[model samples]
Target: MPNGEERPISYASRSLTKAEVNYAQIEKEALGIVFGVRKFHQYLYERRFTLMTDHKPLVKIFGPKTNLPAMAAVRIHRWSVELCAYQYDIQYKRSEDHGNADMLSRLPDGQEQETEEEKVCFSYINDMPVSAADIAKETKKDQTLSKVLQFTLNGWPSHTEDTRLKPYFQRKEEITVDAGVLQWGIRVIIPATFRKQLLNELHENHLGINKTKAIARSYVYWPNLDDDIEAMIKD
Candidate 1:
C-alpha cells in the first residue's frame, strides 16, 4: 500500500511467471543443441530464449546461421526478418551436455514439455560442408582399423590351414561383432575358437580408449577378413 506521505512501490517487488519472463522461444530436435549452451543464451535474452542447433537441416528452418550448412542457410534467411521484432543471442554447447533438452524435445506433439507460449522465428546461417578429408585422414601407424583398411585396399589376403592351430586364425569373423562390415565389402570368416578368443579380447580389454583400435587390429590379423577401415569409419 502507498500513502501520500510514503514513496511509491517499485517494479523490483513484482514477481515474474514463466511466460512473463520469456520473450523468445526456441527448440533443437537433435542432441546438437546442448543444455549449458541453451541455458546460457536463455540468460542473455532476459525475457526470451532463442534456440540454436547443429542439425544444419533443422537449424536453418528454425534460427539464424551466419555461415553454416545449406539446410541452415535457407531457414536463417526467412527467420532474420521475423527476428527483427526482438533481440536474441545464439551460442554453442556440446552434445552430451544437452541430454535432458534432447529427451524433452522428442516427446509427442501433445506431450511437449510445458513451456509458456513464445513467438518463434525459425532461421539459420549457411556455409560449405566441413572438410572431413583432412581430419578423417588415415595413417600407417593407425593400426587395427587402419591396418585392416590398408589390407583391404591391397586386396584380401589368402588363408591357409595349419595343424598348429585348428583355424590358424587370431580372431573370429562374426558378422554382428563388426560394424559396417557389409559396406566395406568384407565379412569375417573364422572358426568358433577364433570367435572365443576375439570375444575374450573384447571382454578382457576394458580400457575405453582403444577398444575400436584393438577390434580393428584383430580383424586385420584374423583369417578370411575383408573391409576398408575408411569405409567402416564413414559408416
Candidate 2:
C-alpha cells in the first residue's frame, strides 16, 4: 500500500461550541488541525506523518520550521505550541481535492461535551474567590467589558471611538470567552464590580506591589491592570 494511495484508519467529528463557532475562519481552521491531531494522538504520536489541510495559510503557519509572529492570534499561537509536540509535515490540499475530510466535516455528530482537561480548568475556578457565574454576570453589567465580550464572541471592529474600549480592541486577538467568562489568553478578565474586591484579596497578604502584580497577572486581566495594582499599593 505504499503506492501513493490513501487509506482511512479512523474517523472523528464534533460540533463546535458557541464560542468556537464565532472564531475567525483562520482560528477555526487551526482548531481543526489541533482537534484532529489530538483525537488521534495515540496513533500519531512518536511517528512521522503528513498533515493535510485545505487551508493554505496553515501550511506556512504550522510548518515545522516556521517562526510564528509575536503578534499572531493568541489562540493560534497556543495551538502552534501544542503542535510542536508532534513530528509531522503540514501540507496544503485544495478543498475540492480534500474529499474525505470534507465529507466528514459535513456530518458532525453533535455539540462537543467538555473535555476532561476543560473540566479540570473549570474546577480550578471553583477554588478561586470569584466564580465563573459571578464574572459572567458582572461582565454583562459592566458596559465596557460587555462590549468587549460581544466583540470577542462576534468580531472586533477595526476601530472604536470610545477610549475605554480602545485597549480591549487593540488586544482583541488575545481575547476569548469560555463558560460565559471573558478571558485574555488564560487570564480571566475581571469586571468593574469585581476589580475592587479582587484587588483587596490580592493585597491581603501584603505581598507588596511587584509580588501582587505578578500573582494578579497570572490569574486576571483588566485594562491598566498593572497601574491599578500600583495605585492600590501606593495608597
Candidate 3:
C-alpha cells in the first residue's frame, strides 16, 4: 500500500489441472502457495510481505523452527522446503473471510470469455418466496428437531447417539449450533425437505449468486448447497 491506500499491483487466476483438482485439500492449499510464489517470485523475491491463508495447517507446517511433520505426505515436504526460500510470516484468516479465492475456485468452466461486468455481477433473481421465520418456527416445533435445536443452542455432548435425539443420530456429527442457531459447520442445518424453500427465501432478493451464497453461509447448511443454488438460479 502506497500512501496508506491499498492498491492492486498484480493478480492471477487459473483453473486447476486434472491432477491438481484431484489433490487432497491440504495438498491443494500447499500447491497454491507454491504456485503463487512461483508466478510472482520476481516481484516478491527481494521484498518481504506476510503470507496470508485461510488454511491454518499450512501455517503450522511452515512456521520457523518447526520440524517436518511425521505423517505429512511427500508432496507436502517438498512444498514446505520450497517455501523456505521466502522471507514471510504466515497468518490465518477464516475461510468465509477469504472470498475471492473461494469464488475463483467455484467459477464454472469457460468463464474466461465472460466480461468483468459479467463476472461478480448478477442480473436477476429466479427464486420463489418463502418465509424464513415460519419455516424455522415450524421446524423447531417438531419434537425431534427441537431436541437438536436445543442442543445447538445450548451445547451438544461430545459423545453421540443419545436415544432421545435418535432422529439426529444418522448425521449428528455434522451438526453444529452457534448463538442459538443450528448449523452444519458453516451450513445451517434445517429439515431436509425444506431446503429448497429455505434456499428460495435466501435467494429471493436477487442478490447475485455469491451474495446469496454469502447470506446462506451465515445461516444454513446442506450438502452441495452452492451447486444447488447455482442450479436454482439457472432453472
lDDT of candidate 3 at residue 71, scale 0 to 100: 37
Worst 10 residues of 1 by lDDT: 121-130
Candidate 2 TM-score to native: 0.68
Error of 1 at 69 (Å): 11
lDDT of 2 at 109: 75
Candidate 2 C-alpha lDDT tens digits along 1-235:
5997777777888888756765655677788889899989999999998999987768888999999766555668878999999999988889788655546656787787655544554565675788898988989989898888777766667689999999888776656666668776678888999888999888888999999999998788888899999999999
lDDT of 1 by residue, 2-106 (tens): 553423221111222332222111222222233223334444344565555533333443344444333222223334444534454454545654443543344
Compared with the true structure, model 3 gives a TM-score of: 0.42
Highest TM-score, which number?
2
Candidate number achieving the greatest lDDT relative to the actual structure: 2
lDDT of 2 at 27: 70
lDDT of each: 0.32, 0.80, 0.60
Write out the backbone clash pairs for model 2. none
Q: What's the C-alpha lDDT at position 143 in model 1? A: 34
What range of 10 consecutive residues in model 2 has the weakest lDDT sum? 114-123
Residue 85, model 3, lDDT: 86
> Candidate 1, TM-score vs. the true structure?
0.22
Q: In candidate 3, which residue pairs get closer than 3 Å at backbone N, Cα or C atoms, i.e. clash? A: 187-220, 187-221, 188-220, 188-221
